[model samples]
Target chain A: MNWDYLLSLFMGGLTRGSIYALIALGYTMVYGIITLINFAHGEIYMIGAFTALIAIGVLTLAGWNGTAILLIAAVAAVVYAAAYGWTLERIAYRPLRHAPRLSALISAIGMSLFLQNYVRMAQTANFLPFPNLIPEFAFLKPVAHIVRSSELVIYAVTALVMLLLTLLVRFTRMGKAMRATAQDRDMAMLSGVDVDRVISLTFVIGSAIAATGGVLIASHIGQINFYIGFLAGIKAFVAAVLGGIGSLPGAVLGGLVLGWTESFFTGYVSSDYEDVFAFLFLVGILIFRPSGLLGRKQMEKV
Target chain B: MKAEFKKSLLAALWFMFLTFPITVVRVNTIERTVAWRWERLIWIGAATFILSFIWRRLLHRKQTGRREVSAGEVRPPSRWKQMAADPRLKGLALSAAALCFLVIPLLFSWNKTILVTNALIYVVIALGLNIVVGLAGQLVLGYVAFFAVGAYSYALLNYHFAVGFWAALPMGAALAAAFGLLLGFPVLRLRGDYLAIVTLGFGEIIRIVLENWNALSFGPSGIDNIPPPGFFGLALTLRQTHIAIYYLMVALTLLTILVVHRLQHSRIGRSWEALREDETAAQAMGIDTTGAKLSAFALGACWAGMAGVVFAAKQKFINPGNFTIWESILVLCIVVLGGMGSIAGVVLAALVLVILPEALRVFADYRWLLFGALLVLMMVFRPGGLVNARRRAYAFEPSAPEKSERP
Candidate 1:
């Protein structure tokens, strides 16, 4: 047991988990409401990364520095990505709402393909470098030696986002509408909850959060590409499932656990088997608790 | 006429805009972002406009007034239906199809013969998948895993033990069946999306194993110089080999159709249909849900394995890349697009999916994009598929209804 090695892996896992948690939050929220996997969610994330790259490039020309530039770029990315998410829902999903679940899933998959190729065609298939924008934090050296400023930024941003999301869901009228709609669409409609608006809002918010994750991940990885969103999206979806899909806390927990599992597996076992192990874990979870770690066991209505 | 043209123009522009985000290239490596190709958009728009008018006049006129019967309903007799109803006409049509298929290579060049051969292979794959997803109502996302397993089994047996194609054929299928059982047991409780993902995971695991286990699979480089199957004891030249494989694929495809058609009429077939319709009701009526599910899995795997052996034999090489999720997605698309549980639909879909893409040639770069978009569009417009399988209109009634009626 190398304490130093373990500590580094743990820190690395935490940052990775934060990214997964961001993406998982979107997956869980959308799934909770409509029960569609939103296969395009990953592509949305990639688009976010690309948008951020373009934004940073423009901002850099405008001679902005440090946190101010990062903030503006991040906001720009989130807004653009939220718009993409909303459009996708409107075009691909809303039309197929009354259709079979398989239809929506297929639509999502199509949207994903469309978006991935769209980006690949628009942006170079080659990896574009993302700017490092986080300011140095001089005070964290004593508390955790392995923690870097950018990583610390990721942790803080993710925590802040989650807190804000929790507040939004708990306190806001729209949040209440979303929760009500998720609970029972018919009943919610009867109660004057605009289920349609709530679903759209869910997509909007989820995409925004996923965008934020995309920015952070791009910064962390120091590069962005068309293909980045897929594997990350899948792992995050698995995490969302692991935590019990449709549960916010479950998604976060699952993301963290999945991140840690990969890190530890990579550290202790063969690195080549990381994805294999993650997939196996997903299979195990599916076999044992199909509802997931915290998912409500659904009853088949006669 | 103007309205239709306007509609076509709008559709074309929409497609252009949809392709815009992916089509416009931006590279910042050395601060250069140039979007190449403006004329392609014009080509697309022009093509769509021209084709839309032709299709509207030629094809849409005939189908414009046909009643859209839901799946499982017995459609009213049409020209095709009337022709199909006559045994003499049906036999003649079948003979014509067989004859056409046989003479296709002779009429076309060698490239087309190979393409048709590949299309024939896809038909076999689609038919096998139809058994699980279409007939059994189980969506197995990792269906390609079985196909890959079959190919590997054939390849490895031949490579390691000098086992010829004849011996390896059954061996490959059996091994694939054994794997299907192994993977199917744990997922018996799962349904729909859950079953899909687990199967997908199972497929990925198998792929990873094949990729990593260098000694067995030769890793990513793939095994080459694989011996093609012989005609009993006769050796074949390259040209003759292509013809032999083509006919071999034809025989196998026909064999698959016969087996599947027969199975659909058997006692077990009825059980699968019941299981597919409503698992809970089927179980309540003592349908042995797990047994039906496993059998479907096994049988589907068996066919996929046989296809795999044929594919390996034809290619004379095997690689892990040949067995990717794309392959699974392709087969699944065929089953879904063709109309689940419709044998003729699967055959039609297999031809359309394989032949159209291969024939187009230029759209090869956008293959997955085209496939994915078509899948989504198909689902949206025709959820039941191109030829939706009707509810069992010719099958056994469960004893419950009969017992209640008697009482």
Candidate 2:
């Protein structure tokens, strides 16, 4: 491939990877803390996108500036998604904690189905064009390649969010509590951590990040749909697993790897099999390193 | 004997009572237009529901005395005894009777071959899935990948090498198995949901490849007019030789079931179960966990490949759309609802899952809703499955001399 084309592909992959990484953080965090896949996290993202879409639409109808409207929409979507995440855990997952892993998984699947179909029923099962929130501007014009202002915005926002999340987990008391709970729930509880509250907060934070990713993705893609979550959810989950499912940094790395793989596959081979290439990469990673790149392998008790 | 006779008589009476209104509705609807059939159908359904409720209540009352007599003697039955005492013989007898009933219709029918052929195709898919999910305890969400591989392999070979169906069949299976090996390597480290997601991704990738690889897969338009299997000098076409294809499908299905059954009871099967029950324990027991898991994937993929060949021949066309995630989910549902690890359960499930939707064609729009509801209900009520495998019981008895140790 030509350098210019390669450069564009690289940029595209990076931008897309950033979004995947953002969404994947949510998966990694929830999995780290509760060992649940949080299957509905993608739906939470979908809700966030829709929430932003609605918020923007309403604001624009009320004659608000595009920048001001986007800011409000982002905040509203994150808060709404966080609340939704909190309620979802309380209602579907909390009681099932003592149940088998499979039961919780099935419940998660149920919640996913309920949310997806509920959205399908509520909204028309078609892609709704997301209005351009950020104006298009060329960041890199030297190589005849242009980066949209939206892409730059998404990358910056995602990086900022990731940085904030890292700090929150590393430095905050609640973050330490979450880490403790994740290590051993019983011990965490014994240590006077409100394990339940910590878990709920984890979901809340994860959902908020996912919501942000969703809005960014919607804007980047310029369209949103009810079924968008299905593939993205799986991919994000793959990213989580690839990075070492429970590790935050691993998720970001996995997401970038996946995004790069897809971009290269599409660039070199064909766009049609982009999904296939990505999965093959995932499968390859799993075979060689089951613990993922950054994940620690645990010995199963016989 | 007298009580048995009375119970049989009552059951027959109840059956006739429920059937009477349905017959009446059918007769009445014959004079009216077919559009009004729904109204009559509703009325008949209501009547049947009421009759069944009353019959169940009466049966419940009569069973109370027998319950008291059998109280305090609840002991587990031996596996052999349980198998021998199974009431499925009546179902077999009923099927035999139904076959006889259909004999005259078959002679006069034109679509007999198609119905049987379709059933056999489903049987193949079910049996293939049984090897993966049922025998191995590995949840594969993108089984359609193998199916697609088989179909496309056949298409490419037929077009390029001019290989006939028989040659393509083995080639297709081999190709799918190769892909399975490729997939199994990475996913060997992953378990359950992680493996499932990867497999799902693999499937979508395959589909997208089929859609985008225009030179090979012909993109989304797919390969058309796929040639049927030619045995010796005879060409098996859908029109004149539909019965031959039907028999071919039946033979293939039988072969699939036999292989699956054999594999399920083999050492490999035991290893799979060991891994499923406790992977670490299996590994500790000297089982090569990676090899076992790969074998599961390869074998499962091989069967799916064979099914794909059959599907292509039956349809005389192959398209990417035919292999979708929903199709994979449906197959997964079949294995789950059929009772995991039980061959008979999977077969029964496949039949019901396929036939029920066909039977409910009139309620087409509500089919998915009903299917989803049934899945949720089944998981809720009998998550183990309809014919849950009996748990192996230990023949442990407290020794009189050892009793003081606990005290």
| Alpha-carbon TM-score of each model against the true structure | 0.89, 0.77
**What DockQ does each prediction reach against the true complex?**
0.46, 0.12
DockQ-based class of model 2:
incorrect
Error of 2 at B31 (Å): 46
Tens digit of per-residue lDDT, candidate 1, span A180-274 = 98888999999998888999999999999999999988987799889899788888989999999999989999999999989989988888777
- Candidate 2: list runs displaced more than 4 Å: A1-10, A58-65, A87-114, A135-145, A257-270, B1-84, B87-116, B166-171, B229-240, B358-381, B391-407
| Candidate that scores best on TM-score | 1
Q: What digit string (tens of lDDT, one per residue) describes model 1 on residues B94-211?
A: 8998899989879998888988999998999899889998888888889999999999998888888999998988888898899899988999998776677678778888898889
**Candidate 2 residue lDDT tens string, A1-302:** 38767877887888878888988999999998888888788988987887777667656665777588989989988887887788678656775676445545655665666666655654447787788887656544453354667778888997898899999999999999999998989999999999999999999999999999999889888898888887788788878888998999999998888887777778877775566666776777777787898999967644
Candidate 2 chain A, which ten residues in sequence have the lowest lDDT sum? A137-146
Interface RMSD of each: 2.7, 12.7
Model 2 / residue B94 / CA error / Å: 8.2
Q: Which lDDT value does model 2 have at A244?
A: 93
- What lDDT would each prediction earn against the true structure? 0.84, 0.75
Best by DockQ: 1
